[model samples]
Target: MEKSTNLSTCENVMTCPIRPIGSGNEHCPYDWLAVYDGRDEHSPLIGKFCGLGKFPFSIIGTSQYMYVEFVTSPAGPLLNTGFHFNVGNWPGHVETAGIKHGVCDWLLSSDSLKDSSASEGIFLSIAHWYPPNTSCSYHIKGHVGEIVRLYFPSFRINRIESPILKYEGDCGESLTIYDSDHADPARIIKTFCDTFSRPMEKVDFVSTSPSLYVQFDSKTGSYSGSSLYYWAHYDFFNNTRFGDPVPNTLCDEVMYAWKHPGGRLRSPLNSLIFKRTGGSDVRCQYKFVTDRRLYARAIIEVNSVSFKELPYNSNACTRCHEERVDKLVIWEERDKYQNNLACFCDNIPRAVRVISSADQMNLEMIVQGQHAITSYFKNPNPLFEATYEFAHGPLCGPITLGPSPDGELVFPYKKALAMVSGPMAPPEHHYRREKCIWELKVAAQRDLWLNLEKARFADRSCDSAKIEVYLAGRLEPRFVVCPENISLARDLPILTTAELGATGADQEPLPVLIQYTGDGQPGRNIFRLVWTELFHLPRNPDGSLAASLLQDGGCDFRCPGDTEVCIPKHLLCNGIPNCPNVTHTSTLSQLTRHIEWNLEQLGLLHHAGDYQQLVLHDESPEICLKRDLSELPYGKLSLIALGLCLMFALLFAILRRMCRSSSLHQGRHHLQEDY
Candidate 1:
């Protein structure tokens, strides 16, 4: 098929001499080629082209397997004519996975324009022709946990010779992007048509999911060439959530530009000072929405927020009055004038209540900075810090997870147990500054057991500033623990244990609420909790294995060295010393020696930090500790003498061993002959 190799031009390097071939010629009337995405014929179909069209066409393929099938109508008559045309530069490489930099790895330094596909990096570009009344869709799936980012350097749709191309409504040609596989209209992240005036605004479209889909459509419009000059420069990055913050919308502006309509301004914007610029007023608006059923009672907590003073730009807020300027307003609804829930100016508010009945909330921070003629663009200092979350109930406070006290919780028993936020305790400093709550419900068959590894708090200060664990249907707490008291204990203390009856026992599932109250200390309160569901094993009268409860608790095999700790059956003979001294047999010693010997041979006798680094396969280690004897402070003669001594020693040993073996063999042979 006829195809354009160059990304910029459509003219071929070699053109047909403008002479028509004879009718009797057996050459194919149509010029066509099928290009695949991968290296070989088995690769996915990228596109199919016909005639001398699709010039300046851009197609990406893999390095080794990208195959091209050229089709001819009559098979082989024009073969004798030896007609050839120069195609443009080879198609660039496309990366489906792996790390990528800005530079294209497909371009070799020696052969700059070689026709080859790229086998490395995670960057891809797409520039294709959209035939009339036709639609082409592309689905790019990145490695697991990765998000795709597409950058459009140049975008044009339905370009003609007369009027300049510009973004117009209902354009005949359009390009749509989706964050997911299904291309529903509501799910359209961004739609492009015509063109942008401001250098295209460097629009970066990011996929919230690991997969991104792009569709190019043309509605039988008149155009000189292809409807779109859609060259996309894109890469894949690991996905992150709100807690991590770095990879979230607030941190990476381009990656999260499509979070709201028309993109968010100064995203990841938190605690930055605001100064008046020119004649425009400075106001920052942030709107957050939560699922109505999922987050019914939500609140935003802002601590230690105050508009005080700055060094040089102190005069920036000259126009803002202390009583009514540079303030933050919280709104329960979109109508800010009437639905303002709370406003804070020059002082921090404890907590701003978000409207529970609705699914959306708006936050607006205004800084009426005084216009300074000389100091115009000074960076603002941090204004405040806030966090939003849903509370279980009004009694448990806004920081607690789960519903209110009256809300029913049902947890089912499972074979495996897991913790949501991990078993490790949060930072002690944060515990003192904030109050946190957690609620857990165990299934009816669960026999829940709670253990505290460590707890530390104020020493005998007040009982009110402590942790309290409450069980459902009970007014008194099952356990009132002081972190300081627990810290003084020698061994871990079992906090509580609740056992539910068997099925159809008319028993309610266990519901537990854990709350930690701060003692107004910066770094004095901390605790860790680990809960396990115990299974009652039916042991025989002789105290042997229980047929029914075998492996119920996941630890079935007893350690040979120490029966005190039962290990998982899978851990037995898994190369790890699970049985302590009993498992540390000659096999362990031999494995250790082998590793050490390999390390010595590589001259990298440094202790192995990661076991994978110690394992030697086809790839050799880069670092070694071995030193060359020639580099030492010795003459050439000395080095030669040392080498000669070693050579003689080795030769003598080999001769002695060979002679002894030969003698033994001769003796045996002679005996056999005598017999």
Candidate 2:
């Protein structure tokens, strides 16, 4: 099928006859290759990709999820089934669920891609799982060719491109990204001499079919339960560590296919395990056996497909149902009727009440994480929300995600659970006044449960879980998770500061969240706190505690661990947006320009702080600026002009209509009806 796309051009290396990223052919792509290998998993191949093995298979495109092929030799007795391909720092590694696949494990043979053949590519192992797993095989028909290699950008990352292509041929066809739409993948490929300096924005994928189109009808989130999949590994005393022990480390790769998608096909009478490996584009070649359309009905089949598990982390997280109330109020709450709640003002006018009943604030939380975090399956919309109501009437929503033209002023953050906070004595002394500055790690995004040994998928399949919480901290123990409070109580507390003094406090990681997976593997993630010490713990009148850095109009409130001295201005309102006060002037200081007139017109200038804040909050004013409308860019001037004209026209018409109606009614009533 002929297809094309409008791809944005970016820089890449010089083209060498234009190789696809993993094209197995010639055509340079925009992104450069970072790593390539054909080594056994027992020893991971980690090095800079200067270019090796010709890659033999050019990876032209990728889907949200793809399969890895492993075929058996004629000498093999096991059936074929599912496969795995761990790429880079992602869910990276290959595992087995079928019968033993040793030296003859791969289907891509040495001679598969020799320059002499018409197929013109190497023969690789058939990746499908069979026998011990299940009988499923890929049957390549027509001018069959296979392309095997990782992609720079996985199809899932480019979800925007999905609808742009569809099946045009009468047969349900698929489209493969031949190149960067405008450029080649391989030719632009650059060789990174250093491994530590590799660019991380790109993605990778592998394929077995040489066809541009490999059908991916349904896709699921990547596997999580498997530490073998997380791209991180640990050294453990026992083989079965990380939370719970796994019964059978692996499963057989067997599946039963009752119906085929193409109407022209018959169900398999018995299990079908194609001899996938022995190299050379190893998928079975179908000549229709006798040239029937049923053989043509075959689509790519996946075997030994394993999944991960999910955890509620109810132990570590506090929500409405399970309140960890009264322990600690890390986040603050305010009534919509009173904008002065976060402010120290004694009396706010009732006419311009800060708290209003007109808005619903689902945003009722704030948290501090221990380390890098990940978000699994959180089925909530407006996933992140923050509201700042100025003494003025305007409320600014949290910064919207996507391309930020003004650049990201507030730090981007991720959410998860980690090990640092359980059953431990608080630190003795806060840090001495270094700088008035304190920065928290809101940019990295996730937390982790590290040093796991065995992973068993429980509640796998389409189910994933997250850890969201309320303002309260709990005294009760967390559920099933091995946090500092739980995991350490076992063998952790025994280890001391002397033992780990050089190792930065020996903090154990905790599980924050888990994404979707199958019954065999489960996922866990967490959040991190870079630094958050500005808010002082104040002694409330009732012997309770409140977050404060100001006392009696001074900034002498006591600070927390490793935070001895903090500038009072830095400890404002829950320590977000780095604004000391929740008002109009403070918010505007973060912007480039201002227009204070708009606030005055709205009767909302009470919180302008000073004249400076007034200007920042309103870039569009009630009166005209010095610049001429015609001289300024049309796009900018037209918008403001249109808004003003519309406002004025609306007011005039309302007043005019009222006067005429009133006059007519007065005349009729005064005259009295003759009848």
Candidate 3:
């Protein structure tokens, strides 16, 4: 009773597990004498592969490359030889797999067809094995036809021209592509069609193999092509095709076609690049999907050009606060810091919303960089310096935002709540912070000395307060905060922001000016400086400060069901597609997400405490002193309702002086008659 066995090898190859009879082989009948490498692990003879002549083969895993490919040397003396699968270890092995880090199970390229004659009739060998994390199912005993192509560095190639195809919009059915290098002004091609217009079309239908959604956006699109759910007929102009690039391989997936919704999906060897600038008045469209299954589209017609106004070194803190911005808010951050104050090589999306005034709300915005996190609420301290940590590049290094691992001088938990200043209060006001510029000595006092005065509260605001000032910014480049107060808009009150209220309540103490910039010394964040307060103006009881405000036309409030929730996806979208209630050519509701500035001058969103627990963190100083003691309630019944109405008017004047002294003591009869 002696049966079980195993063994294997490579190099003139040999294998055996158990067999002996006329061994067969076309692919496998199994039989081959013996071979197994076991050098020592205390040798239990636990390794085997023995067979003779008749044929034997079995080495199911982890054995790659070292081929022989049915050799007997054809084309005279091994011509440029091929077949080399080098991996060793086999003997009663079943199947075990795992590997997924930079993938390379086994591959060696350069295989010139082995037999131009005995020149190199390499035997057969194409080994396989993969080990790491692990996953294996094993089947498809066989069926082959392969192709794969992948390219990206975020793409930007535009030509090579012709020969690979796939794409069909006009209700056909073909998609997938590649090919690039073409940029006829491809400045993001009018910012990808003005950032996909029609208020930024929100999505009628788009499924890129989302389990088969076919295609969509018909101006108002559909899915599975369409008849009720079909109509892939999109001809911005005779189907859609552009040029260049055609050498492909590796799991292809091109699918890019768009009337809007940011386009790009073409490749079959390509030549791509297009730039035309937004809200196209005359023409623009693009498409791609190639790797042979073809579909391409393009229609350019540009020169409309609408995108400019943004420069001051692309905004180093509002061009240094608009060169000492004196014009308090005349509205013009046009759409969230006006395309972020400048520098848009191209990416479109900040449309409209300008009107800003009051010398542009105190004006802020200055930049440089470093590394600052605590989720950065206010910055500008070396902005990750060292010769500008490679300067604000789309980069990835240098980061700084100064002192807060418990050092706390400013912001350990406040979060970037921005504040622009100068509520007209002149005579004296100053501030700089990174190098010291403190001038504002303000004194208004009374919220009962503000909970017993905390260092008279400097930059956290409010103490005696109406306004209070000491302003000047971008750190005056580095130091100095109060040297230019020409009576700062004479006397006070111009914080001015009336999109209908809340920007002035008898102004005075508001002389804010906290500009930052470092390397000017003390504490650092590489190269620091990022101010961004961007406008908040008001002053005009004669002290000057009204460069632009009386325009007043666009905002009376209204805009709701017109409930239109939150607009600003570029104005509510249009070029094509619409859904649930606007998302394509934009309808713009942005009264800016339910307005409530308990503070949030546009950093996005954040709020904490103290300003008296932030107006009593949701009220309860006894419900705001019982709603301010129900506003006067007759002054808590003013002294018993005025002492019961002055004791009923002093008892009616003592009953008219005792009834006129009893009518003159009864002599009234005689006196009446005589009268």
TM-score per prediction, in order, is 0.30, 0.14, 0.18
Off by over 4 Å in 2: 1-252, 255-559, 563-653, 661-675
Give per-residue CA lDDT, model 1, range 1-675, as digits (tens): 223211112254254333222111132235445556566778665454443232342443334345666555444323223323332444544434432223222211111111224321233333332224555565655656656666666655445322112334455566777887657777788777644322243465777677777776656422123445555655554443233233323232111112321211221232211221334445655655544222333345555355644464444443332343556666666445446666666554354333322445555666555632122232243455666654222222232232211122111101111211236533434332234456565543334445554455556654535666676545466676664456433222222223232334335354566655555333344445444433333458897545665534444433222112333334333332322232333343332333443344334456444443332211222222122331255687799999999999999999999999999999999999999
Query: lDDT of model 2 at residue 442?
Result: 16
Estimate, for each residue in 1-675, the C-alpha lDDT of model 2 and write its tens digit: 111111114244233233221211132122222222333333322211111123322221112233332322333312212222234332222332112234223222213323234322222222211111111111111122323332332111112111212222221211222212112344222222111224322333222233221111111111121001012111101111111212331101111112211122111111111111112111111111111111111111111111111253334322422343111111112353322112111112221111212221111221112110122111112111112221101011121222110112111112101111123422324211110001111111111111212222222322322111111122221222223232222211111122212223233211121111111110232222112213223457885544462343323222111212222322222222121122323233334222233234333345344444332211223212321232358786799899999999999999999999999999998789754
Candidate 3 regions off by >4 Å? 1-474, 477-512, 515-654, 657-675
Worst 10 residues of 3 by lDDT: 385-394
Candidate 1 Cα outliers beyond 4 Å, as residue runs: 1-81, 94-151, 157-174, 189-212, 217-227, 233-314, 317-364, 367-383, 387-461, 465-675
The lDDT, on a scale of 0 to 1, for candidate 1 is: 0.43
Residue 383 C-alpha lDDT in model 2: 19
Q: Please report, as a residue range, the 10-residue window in candidate 2 with the lowest summed lDDT.
A: 431-440
Sort every candidate by TM-score, greatest first.
1, 3, 2
Better candidate number, 1 or 2, judged by lDDT: 1
Q: Count the backbone clashes (under 3 Å) in each candidate.
A: 16, 128, 210
User: How many clashes would you count in candidate 2?
Assistant: 128
Q: Model-by-model lDDT, in order? A: 0.43, 0.23, 0.22
